[model samples]
Target chain A: MSARDTILARVRDAALARPEAATNREAQVAERMTVGPKGIIPHQGQATGPQKLRQFLEKLEANDTTVTRVSSEDEIAHAVARELRKRNLPAAIRMGEDPMFHAQDWGSLDVSRGPGRLEEPVTLSRAQFAIAETGTLVLTSGPDNPVTLTFLGETHFVVLRTEDLRSGFEDMWGDFRKRGLDPRTVNMVSGPSRSADIGQVLQLGAHGPVALHLFMVG
Target chain B: MSGHVPTSSAFKSNSQEALVNRNLQAALRGSRGNFIAKRAAARANVPEFDDIRDQARDMKNHVLANLDLYLEAYEKKVTEAGGHVHWAETAEDARRIVLDICRKSNAKTVNKGKTMISEECGINDHLAENGIKPVETDLGEYIIQLRGEIPSHIIAPAVHVTVPEIEEAFRKHHAHLPPDRDLSELASLQAEARSELRAKYFEAEVGITGANMLIAETGQSVIVTNEGNGDLSQSLPKVHIVMASLEKIVPTLEDSATLLRLLARSATGQEMSVYTTFSSGPKRSEDPDGPEEYHVVLLDNGRSNMIGTEFEEMLRCIRCGACMNHCPVYQSVGGHAYGWVYPGPMGAVLTPSLIGVEEGGQLPNASTFCGRCEAVCPMRIPLPKMMRSWREREFEKNLTPSATRYGLGVWAWAAQRPWAYRLAARIANRSLGITGKSKFSKLPLAGGWTKFRDFPAPQGGTFMDQWKAGKR
Candidate 1:
């Protein structure tokens, strides 16, 4: 027998070993796969709009991710430029072909549309959704928003709309399903890359972006 | 060289050596309350932490109860997503399957993420013996790999290596670099490691990682990392092989989310890890970057027999390392003393289950039954109870030492007869009350206890006798 058959058979045996055999195992599993049950949603992430935006900013700061709120989408480019200048980084950024990003006036900033490169000083991606519960940025992989840019950039700049901010994973996943884009990867990034491997001292920028600056288009 | 062979049978001696090893003791002391305090603060910050833990436990239990069915569904989804799943009954099977994949991919060097599953299967040594270089990407794992030692701690693999010791290892290994380079700061050390690993990540042909959660709903393997090395490891290689066991499966994305809420907080006190990447399969046809081939090796290595047995609860482990963090014995002696792939209270119960009661029995015996492990366990695994079960099994098998068994026999016999118990208790108390004076500095047949501190004498009599006398 194949290893799969052998292992599955043993699992079946073990489940049946009990006095009350696990009946309807396949049916129950099928039902669960189709109708995925929603477990307890944390009350912490139940707020909406301004209330959630405040919570989201607080949580994002707690993770060392800086956020700048812009009153309109047109200000996103200026905010990104300002952040880059403040950090003394090059005025160059890479991004994908997201129409939301293209609609902005870049104002002579060097912007490339493709995947990430090794020396990319800064890369921008529009967050599909932001979770208020943990201040996580959810980015999907595609031509419009390549996932490599999320990890490859030395300093990552993300554009999130206040309206797209979610309270928790359950709500965010619901939105994802409605959007109906099945990207290869769904990255839920919370903060700058860090490691406590050496003497348990928390050090940032251990392989991913050292700084994650969020441009919140409120 | 091969992987470190199991020295679990000599755990007694190993712990004894660990207690006095100055460097190990210093490292343990430095990190003693860090995890405990962080977990406490994280728990306090979340109002619904316990509720989430409960939901997570229920989800895991539900999946385990119907593992066969879920595995089937998971396989179907993975196949639909253009991925392959290989089933391995033992460590050898896993190693063979992985080797076959690497050979097919023509891999010379493979970058690795931190995966306890690979350690359990001894994948690194197997790959090396077969002429493939396995580069550990996680900083802690890399440090320990350089030292040629098993991880002293799970999450913090090089926790036992002091800062100076790390410097020594780096200097000795990276001799090609400038010898006089300033390695004084932790920042400098991190930069060096980052630069070294960045080059290797791009050069590797295959990247192997361990899955934190396997979602049967979408055929996705989720990995949670703070360092982001797991992402690079999987993303850069031509073939990405996820080393996971059958029990890592969760029913849906929602189920994974519930567990994720508990995971980072319980392990590292983070609201969420920096990177929680969910990779379903290889890159899409239009994707700019990602691996082309995706394979998941589903290892069973004795987990199958654990189902429906008393020890089945061990399968719920998510490899969070929280149990070891909160384990008092572990904090004192450290992880290497457990003498195997796993250590601490979780290891105490799990080691025996995975590798029989003979070689791994001493691990369960090492526990103090403080119940701290179970208290801090996110999945609510009753660790102390299972350790007690192992002790019982050891006794039934006559694997327990004769002295302990005889002593327990005497105590049990005396307790069964109230009159005899009281008579003996009174005699012992009177003798100790008179001879001990304030406390017994020395005692027959208890040098182990008296060597560290004096044993306090009984005040008057046993608690039962005192209670009866007070009533009268």
Candidate 2:
């Protein structure tokens, strides 16, 4: 017999040794997977309105991610430019084919649209949603938001909209399901890369971006 | 590379050597209270931490009770997502399957993220034997790989290596750089490794990573990392192979989220790790970049036997390293003393089950039964209880030391008869009280105990005599 079969049979016998009534195990699993019960959503992640936005920024900064707020989408380009200027980086950035970013007037900035390449100084990607609980940014993989740009940039700059922020993973999953979108990859990035491997001292920017700057626009 | 034989039976000798090694002692001392303090502060920061832990444990129990069904569901979803799953009954099978994939992909070099399963299977040695280079990209794993040694700790692989040793290794291996370069600060060493590994990431043909949690809902393998090496490892190479044990599967994404909430806090005291990437399958056609082929090797070396047994709760372990972090015995000896891929309380129970009791029995007996491991375990697993079970199994198999068995036999026989037990206890106590002279630097039968510390003399008569005199 195949390893899969033999192993599964062993699991079945061992798991059912006491015989807890085999009541259509497949159906039970199917139902649970479909419904996906939410287990113990933290009270910290269940706020709304300005309170939610404030919690999101606090948690984001606590994780070593800096955030800047713009009153309108029109100010996103200027904010991005200002971040680059403050860090003394060149006026160059890479991004994906997301229409949200293309609509912005990137005045005097050199912006390239595609996946990430080696030695990308700075890259911009519009976050699909920001989770308030852990201050996580959910970026889906597609031509619109190439996943490579998320990890390849030396300094990653993300544009998040205040309206797109959710309280927890449950609401974010709801947004994903309602949109009927299934990307090959969903990256939940909390901050810039870091490692404590060298004598257990945390050094930022191990393999991914060293500096992660966020522009929260409304 | 040093040939790593299972020296588990020599745990006593290994621990003694570890205690005396100056470099190892310094390294272990530097990191002794950092994890404990961080975990305590992280837990204190969250009000509902214990509630979440309970929920996580219940979810795992539900999945384990229906493991066959969950595995079937997880396999179906992976196939639906355009990925292939391979089941391996043993470590050899896992290595063979990975090698076959590498051959078919014509992989010359493979980049690897930090995966304890790979360490368990000895994949690097096997791959190198087949003439394929496996580059460990995680900073800790990379350092240990260069030294040709297994990881001392599961999460912190090179926790036993000191700073000077790392600098020396980097200097010897990276000889292409200028010899006079300054490598004094820790930052400089980190910078050198970062730049060195960057080139290898783009050149490798295959990338291998381990899964923290595998969701049966979407057929996704999720990995969490503080550094972005796991992301780079999976995204850069043309083929991505995930080495996972079958017990990693969970019923749904919500279940995964619950466990994720507790995992990082318990492991490193972080609200969330820097990167938590969920790779469902190979890149979609419309996607710009990702691995073209994705394969998952679901390894079940001895996990199948663990299920539905006294050791079944061991599967609930999430490899958080909390048990070892708070373990006094582990804190003293460090991880290498366990003489296996795993260490500490978890390893004491698991090593005996994975490797046979005869070979791994000494590990179970190494514990102090202080119950700190079970107290800090997020999964609420009875780690001390399981280790005791392994000792029982050893005694039943007659693999225990003959002297210990004889002593236990005498104690048991005397205890069954109350009169003989009282008489023997009084005589022994009185004789010891007279001869001990307050403390014993040496003892007749307890050389092991006396060799480390002194044994105190008995105060007076036995408990029965004192009770009869109204002392009770």
Candidate 3:
């Protein structure tokens, strides 16, 4: 027999040996997958409106992620340039074919559109949704937001509109499914990459961006 | 290192050596309270932490009872999403499956994310023996790999290596760099490793990572990591192979959130890990970059047998490492003393189950039964109860040491008769009282107990005698 069959048979035998096994487990599993029961949502995950946005900003700061709220979409390029100048990073930035990015006119910043290369100093991507409870950004993989730019850049800049922010994982995922989006990967980033592997001291930027800045647009 | 021989039978000696090893003790002491304090602070911030843990435990129990159905469902979803699922009944089978994928991909170098399942399967050794270089991308795993050692701790693999030892390993292995460079500060060492490994990330043909959860609803394998290496390892390689146990499956995305809520908080005291990547399959045709082929290897190396047994609750573990972090016995002896891939309270119950009671029987005796592990376990697994069960099984199988069996036999014999038990206790108490010393630095039959510290001498008479006298 194939390994899969043998293993499944063993699991089935053990499961059926129990006295409670009289119930139809197959039906139970199917129902669970279809119904998708929402478990206990923390009180903090249920906040809304300006309170949720405030909570998200507080969480972002707590996790060491810098955030700048721009009053309009046109101001994002200027915000990005200011952050780069503040950090003394290169003036160049790599991004994808997102139309939001295309709409903005980068004034003096060296902006290029493509997938991330080996030595990308700065990269930008648009997050589809943001979770207020944990300050997580949900980015799906596609030409609009290439996944490599998320991990390859020395410093990463993410753009998320205030309207796109959800209270928690449940609402964020709810909005994600409503959009009928199916990307290869769903990257939920809370903060910049970090590691405490060396001497158990936490250090930022381990194989990913050292600094992660958010351009929150209204 | 292709196949690690189990030294668990010699756990007594291994722990003895670990207690006095200066370098190991320094490393263990340095990291002793760090995880505990962090988890405490994280739990303090979450008012509903314990409530969520209960929910997480129940969700896993539901999945376990219907594991066969869930596995089938998860398999179908993966196949539909243009991914392959391979089931391995044993570790050898898992190794063969992973190697076959690497060979087909013509992989010369394979980058690995931090996956304890890969460590359990000994994937790195198998790959190297077949001439495929496997690079560990996690900072901790990379340091241990450089020293040619298996992970001492699951989350912190190099928890047993001191800073100087790491510098020495880097200098010896990375001989290409100038030998005279200053390596005094911690940041400099981290910067050096970062630059060295950044180049290797783009060189691998296959990337292997372990999954924290496998959502049966969406056919996604999720990896929760603080470092983004797991993401880069999978995204940059041409083929991505996820090594996960069958027990990693959850019924839906919401169920995964329940586990996620507790996982990072329990492990490292973070509200959320830096990155939690939920990957479904290979890259979409319209995508700019990602692995072209994705495979999930479902390994059931002894987990299938764990069901319907006394150790079934162990399968509920999310690999959070909290049970070990809060374990006093584990804190003192460190992870290596357990003499296997897993350590501490969980390993005490799991080792014998996976490797058999004869070879791994000694581990259950290493615990003090303080109940701290059970108290902090996010799954609320009865770890101490399971260890007691293992001890019973060991005694029944005659795997226990002869001296321990003889001692237990004597205690049981006297306890069965009240008169003999009282008489023996009185005699022993009188003899100890007659010593006139407050404590004994040496004893006739208790050299093991007295070897470490002095044994206090009994005062006056036995408890039975004292109770009768008080009544008079």
Best by TM-score: 3
Query: For residues B41-102, could you state the per-residue lDDT of candidate 1 as single tens digits?
Result: 99898888888888888778888888988998899889999999999998889999999999
Q: Which stretches in model 3 have alpha-carbon errors above 4 Å? A: A35-37, B464-472
Show where candidate 2 strays beyond 4 Å.
B1-4, B418-438, B458-472
Per-model TM-score, in order, reads 0.97, 0.96, 0.98
lDDT of 1: 0.89
What's the CA error at residue B291 for candidate 3, in Å? 0.4
Task: Indicate which candidate wins on DockQ.
Answer: 3
Candidate with top lDDT is: 3
Say what the RMSD of model 2 is: 2.0
Q: DockQ, per-model, please?
A: 0.75, 0.75, 0.80
**Which residue pairs in model 2 clash with each other?**
none
Which scores better on DockQ, 1 or 3? Answer: 3
Residue by residue across B111-172, what tens digits does model 3's lDDT show? 99999989888899999999999999999999999998888877888989999999999999
lDDT, candidate 3, residue A200? 84
lDDT of 2 by residue, A54-127 (tens): 88989988888998989999898888999999999999999998888889899999999998887899999989
Q: Where in model 1 is the C-alpha error above 4 Å?
A: A35-37, B1-3
lDDT of 2 by residue, B1-472 (tens): 3124677888989999998899999999999999999999988988999999899888787788889999998999999999999999988899999999999999999999999998888899899988999999999999999998888888999999999999999999999999999999998999899899989989999999999989988899999998899989999899999999999998877787888888999999998899998899899998888999999999999999999889988999999999999999888899989998899999998888887898889898888899989998999999999998999999999988898999999999988999999999888798889774999988888887998899998887888988999996
